[model samples]
Each structure stands twice: as C-alpha cells, then as structure tokens.
Target: MERESDVDALIAEGAAAPVDGWAFDWLAGRAAEERPPWGYARRVATRMAAARAALDVDTGGGEVLAELPQSPPLLVATEGWPPNVTVAARTLRPVGGRVVAVTPGAPLPFRDAAFDLVVSRHPVRTDWAETARVLRPGGTFLSQQIGPGTVRELSEAILGPLPPPADRHPERAVADAEAAGLRVVDLREATLRTVFHDVAAVVWFLRKVVWTVPGFTVERHRPALVRLHDRIRAEGPFVAHARRFLVEAIRPAD
Candidate 1:
C-alpha cells in the first residue's frame, strides 16, 4: 500500500517542493486554475503608477509586489513569517521596497497617515484598523481576497465534508472597511474552474497553500490521498471551484 510508485512520487515531490513564495508556477501543467477577469495585478500596477507612497500587506516573498510595472516612490511590504521575511526582502530589494517582518495581528509598524495607497492580494487577516491608521486621507485600498468555500472540493477530498466558510465573506469586508472610515466603492466576486491532473499536483498544492488543509502530510493523510489518486485515474481530472473577491475602497478626503 505504501510502496505505490505514483503515491511515492506524490509524497516525495510535495514534501521536497519549495513552498516559500506566493507564485504557483509549479502547478502549471499538473494543475490549472482560471484567472479572475478583473485582473488584480493589473489593478495594483495601475494604482502603484499613480500613488507616491504605498504599502503591500502580507506580501508573501514580495513576489506579487515585485511585479508592479512601476514602483512607487515609497513602497513598503510586510510579512509575518520569518522564512518569508528573508525571501521577501531579497525579492523586493530590486523594486526599492523593504519587507518588514511583522507580528501577525499586531499593530503595523508604520506611523499613522504614512501611505496614500494600501494593497494586499490575500492576507492572512486584514486588520482594517491598521489599514485605516496607516493610509492617508483620500488614499485608496485595493485588494483581491479569497472568498468563502474556495476549493471546497479539494478540501473535502482531504478532510471529508466540512461546514460552510464562516470568515471570508466579502460583505463582512465592506462592513469592516466602512467601520474603519473607508468608503467601499467597488466589490466583485468570481468562482473559477480549478483542476488537478494528478495526485502529486494536489499534494504539492496542499503543502504550499497550507490553508487548504493545515498540517497535511503524506503519512497523516495517506488514505485520503490514495482515494483521490484513484478518482483522478478513473475520471479525467479532479475538478474544483476557486472563489475570489476584489474590493476597492477609499479613505475619504475629509
């Protein structure tokens, strides 16, 4: 049972795979996920072109921040994990932005009214109060966030059926931003197709994207992995839906 070559490959590749940055190129052929039409990276680059000062929160390895077409005059990014902090600093240096290792859920290290634009792709948790505290009046906040029940199919494959998502709704984001004194000008949500061609792809995915199934390991979830492998071989590809939301808010000029 444990000596299956395909399963062994899956476990070995996943366990050895690098899960440092936010980039997902490793999943290119083995897995695929549709992109949101709104183009969050393009939006972020546009915002960066206009803003003098900006902050990128929870910038995993600063990979996304490094992709900005034009760098802002004062750009800063934050990461909570120590390993990611090192990686982020290296990646962000060329863009002239520094990565600050911050404590998750702690107050941001920056002073009040320090930045005119604040952006994050998918933060662990959005501290609206800190976001509002750092953003200057009339500043903009643009983010593409993970929505409720993203990749539920993959999740259930790993951990069996689960309850609906409780935390990641976009409506709650609007309320929080509003409470933080930011005007929510736009909100959009999308559910996109996601597919895994093989068990290794799924294994690598879960290992890299920890939130999919925290503490997942080949030894721990071998049975589930075997079942999923069988399903992929019988069917074409394991299909799932990924949901994401985009929110654009502005701090009032007043």
Candidate 2:
C-alpha cells in the first residue's frame, strides 16, 4: 500500500506545472505533423465549398483553414486563448481571415442563421448546442474531436487509475444538435496512432500541447515525472494510441 501511494505521489508531482509556451509550442508542432490529413478542416471545407460564409471554432494556428481552396466571404476564426488567438490571427490575417478571441464556455458571438458552415476541431466548449444555435438553415456542422482514450497511459501513470473506458460523450453534442432541430447526417470514429521520441516528449505534450485537464502543480507532478522516467526506461519508447471521432450533422432545409 505504501509503495502504491508512493507511485501515485510520483505521478502527481510529475504532472505539476502550468501548461504554457513550451507546452503549446511542442503541441503545435506535433499537431501540425500528426493530425489526420482528412481531418476536420478538410471534411468541413469539402462539404461547404459552395457556402457564402463559414466559421471555424478554436482555429489553432489556422493550418486547417488555410487548406481551403476558396476562402469564404467571412472566414472567421474563434479562439479562447488570447496568445493563441493573436498568433493565429497574425498567421491567418494575411490570407484575409478574421479572428475573434472569446471567453471560455460562453456562447459564441454570432447571429442566428449567420453561417452556412461551422466547423471545429476538438472544441473546448462542453456541448454543441451553441454550434447548432448559430447555424443557418441547411448549414453544416462538422467536427473532429479527441475521445476518452486520448492519453490513457499518461493519465494512468500520472493520475493513478482512470475512469472505466467508455465512448466520449462530447457532452451530448449530437443530441444538442438534434434538439436544436438539426438533422443527423454522419458520424464516424477513428483510432489515431502517434509516436513519441521518448516518454518525456509524451509527458511534455500532455502538459503543454494537449492541456486537456487543469490543476497540475509542480510538487504534485514531480513524483509522477520520476515514475514516468523509470517506466520509460523499463518499457522503452512510448507509443500513444488515441481514439477520435468525426461527426457531421446538418440543419434541415426548411
């Protein structure tokens, strides 16, 4: 029991630290490389090429939006992080895109039926109700998001046992869309595989890049770091497998 407690302590300590610059830089680079080619942006762009206006929620780095062949009249991007928003806006503005930095968990700033297409990649918003609320009749809502198994190994090593494996609810995004009177179109799940140079890289990514959960303090994370290093030495380089879902739904043409 003492050994188990010790291990748990180590895990917590290793995960401590506010995720900031180093983490985002590391994650941005990795996201650029390993994110699926047929990801959220492509999927949404393909479906909405004819639309007059479009919005991308949480447009990190604007890489996905940049891939579109023809830009929308209103190529608006919404970001929650001020720094990231500034960076993304700087990168995207050259291409005639506009950026809006919003407070987290707040309703989006758009009129009803304002957009013909709305897309998001791993949006931090708990539910898609707002997404559905903002879409015009016949507008499309497309998203690709990380599911529950996003960092199973890391979570286990650092945070102790995790909840039982279950399909990510995405806060009932689908149901929210339906309640808003959107028609369910298509939904699919894919397992994504990512390789890390080392366990430290993986840990760095979880802390910096992913930033899924908050409240990791340095004292809490130190022991976890030690355990992770020891585990890596024992187990060899880390390979992370994550489950992601791609969902597409459309507002009915009334």
Candidate 3:
C-alpha cells in the first residue's frame, strides 16, 4: 500500500511537470546520462567562433546555441515544433540569432549556399540534400546524431521486447551525405551510460523524447510504469545505454 502510494505520487509529479524546451534540468537528481567524449557543444563553440554565417537545424529551444561564447555574424536556427520556436527565439535573442520555423523532413527554407557552417544536435531527420544545398562551397556540416537503438533498454522497459535497430547507423548517414555530394571528413561514435532513479524520471523522459515510444502517455503505459517501478525498487537504479554519433561533412570548394 505504501509502495503504491509512492508510485502514484511520483507519477503525478512527473506528469505535471512542464516538458518545455530541450533542457533536462527538471530531471536533475532523478536521472543522469554520461556525456559523449567528442564534446559536441565545445566543438560547436569553436566552429561558431570562426564562422561568418551559420545555420542550426532543428534547434530545440535553442538551448545548445545559447551556450556559445561567440556567435557568427549571421546566426540562424530552425525549429519544427511551434512551442519550441517561441522558446528558441527568446533564448537566442541575446546572441542576435534568428529562429526560423521549418517543417520536419521538408526542404530548408534558405537560398542556395546561404550558410558557411551548418550544425544540428540530434535532429529528428537529416535532409542531406537540403543541407548540402544551403551550405556554401568549402562549407562544413557538423552534427551529433542519435544512433540506432539509443536508450533501447529504457524503451523496452516501457514498451516490449523490440527487434534490432534498423536505421540511424553512422555508415548509412555517411552514405547519404556522400550521395548528397558532401565529403565526409570525420565520424565518431559513443555509447554512454544512462540511469534513472525512479519511474517518474522515465515517464518525463519518454514524454520529452517522444521518439522513445511512438505514443507515450502516463495513463496508457501505467501498467508498464508500475512494473518498472517495482523492478527498480527490487533492483538498483535502472540502467540504459544512449548511442550517439558525430559526423562532419563538407561541400567541396567550387
């Protein structure tokens, strides 16, 4: 009875918390994930320092972009989610960055060769052709992408046993980039540890990272949540692995 009450309270806390912007500060002590060794944010800052013009694709709430110590002369970020567009604009205002609302999987709304540097962190999908089109000759496109089967353990904990990951492989991305006429200069991969102290953390994460469960809801997955909560109580904290990859491609000089 006491365990049930605890579960109920935790679920309510997680469900009621706002899942706005891409920041994960809400999960402070509830969950933790190891950072990738490639240091994507630091790399972006270094590149941004040298860029004349830059574009950030799928800039969720512009949180990552807001961290850069320096900004390009012309800095632009694109977001697909409407809620995030407003958040991103306000967050990037101090940096003189403009936020453009774009449709997911649609062509980037930019003139050819519009940006000298293009970056994206965990974009839902990469339109390689569109990315290439917007990049100037000798420009670079850098991204830290979510690899196939990222956080599969957490996903399966909520959902059921799943099949092998079918896509999001670094090789596939490299092939797509080459096909789009971008030269692949660097590629790196990492599988980092992720831990959740309670079921509430899982609920909030699934809600924010929607791709984890196609259609996640506290009510719909309550049974699984309960089971997971019990399992965590019996075992230690739940553990999962998050896969990430960094790719750097460039357009050849004209």
Error of 1 at 220 (Å): 1.2
Q: Top model by TM-score, which number?
A: 3
lDDT of 2: 0.67
For each candidate, give its TM-score against the true structure. Answer: 0.97, 0.80, 0.99
Best by lDDT: 3
Candidates 1 and 3 compared: the better one by TM-score is: 3
* C-alpha local distance difference test of each model: 0.91, 0.67, 0.95
lDDT of 1 by residue, 114-159 (tens): 9999999988889998898999999999999999989999999999
lDDT of 3 by residue, 56-116 (tens): 9999999989999999999999999999999999999999999999888889999999999
Runs in model 3 with CA error above 4 Å?
A: none
RMSD of 3: 0.7
Please provide, for model 2 over 1-254, each residue's C-alpha lDDT reduced to its tens digit, 9 standing for 90 to 100: 77566545534433553443212444433232255555666666676567688888888667677667777777888888776776777777766788888888888998888898888877665346777778888788888877766757666666788777665665465777688777778777666666554444545565554443345544556676666666665786555666677778888888
Candidate 3 colliding pairs: none
Between candidates 1 and 2, name the one with more favorable lDDT. Answer: 1
Give the residue spans of candidate 1 off by over 4 A: 1-3
